[model samples]
Target: MSDPTRFIPVPTPETAHFWEGARAGELRLQRCADCRKAYFPPRAFCPECGSREVRVERASGRARLYSYVINHLPAPGFTAPYAIAVVELEEGPRMMSNILDCPQTPEALVLDMPLEVTFERLSDEISLPQFRPAKGRAA
Candidate 1:
């Protein structure tokens, strides 16, 4: 569980499954049945082929750090000097999340560093997926 001061996300009809998956300790993504492409920020239609033939699939929970910025300013539910990052999922989609459980430093947060998903439960209906450095992997 995160601090109560943290901003909680509300699940909409299109994103309910994603939240549910996080609650169950899974990272879920949508794939287009027509184009076979995976995408994030769950939507009803595929962004590539404009097809509604999409299915939700559990992701490998593996990713690599693509980009990030070390935040030095205070924010609700977050301490200063945290990394706000974008991770490229193994499924070929990218998602924004916070980097935790490691030193928040540039030298420590290398681009292309291996990462794995972890969840922080904010509520009964919301468990936010975050990432951390992969075990047994070097940056």
Candidate 2:
């Protein structure tokens, strides 16, 4: 069942490819052709070089937990004691997402722990890219 009160993102021209890739079970990111720097939150230009020469590429779906906080406050469509995390992707970009399939605790979410991408479908056109403990990694 879907959460009626959960926030849903509307895809725009800049982010259309990202949403599409998520629905297809791929993590899409933007890279600066001029500087070869990978970036997230898809944009028309690269933040590093300020160049319009950017390209979209599929990510490896691998990352490491960089940081996180366990939220105990209540929020609509969310359970209490959930982890809000920032993960560093293998391709050298960092993104913020919720940690799933693991305990939302300081001990469970160690820094630099390996993670893998997973999708949470919110609608036909929207799927959130989240992360979980990688196979064989202690959760």
Best by lDDT: 1
Candidate 2 collision pairs: none
Worst 10 residues of 1 by lDDT: 1-10
RMSD of each: 1.2, 0.9
> How close is every model to the real structure, measured as TM-score?
0.96, 0.96
Cα misplacement distance, residue 104 of candidate 2 (Å): 1.1
Superposed model 2: Cα runs more than 4 Å off: none
Clashes (backbone N, CA, C under 3 Å), per candidate, total 0, 0
Candidate 1 TM-score to native: 0.96
lDDT of 2 at 122: 84
lDDT per residue for candidate 1 within 1-67, as digits (tens), equals 5568989999999999999999999999999999999999999999999999999999999999999
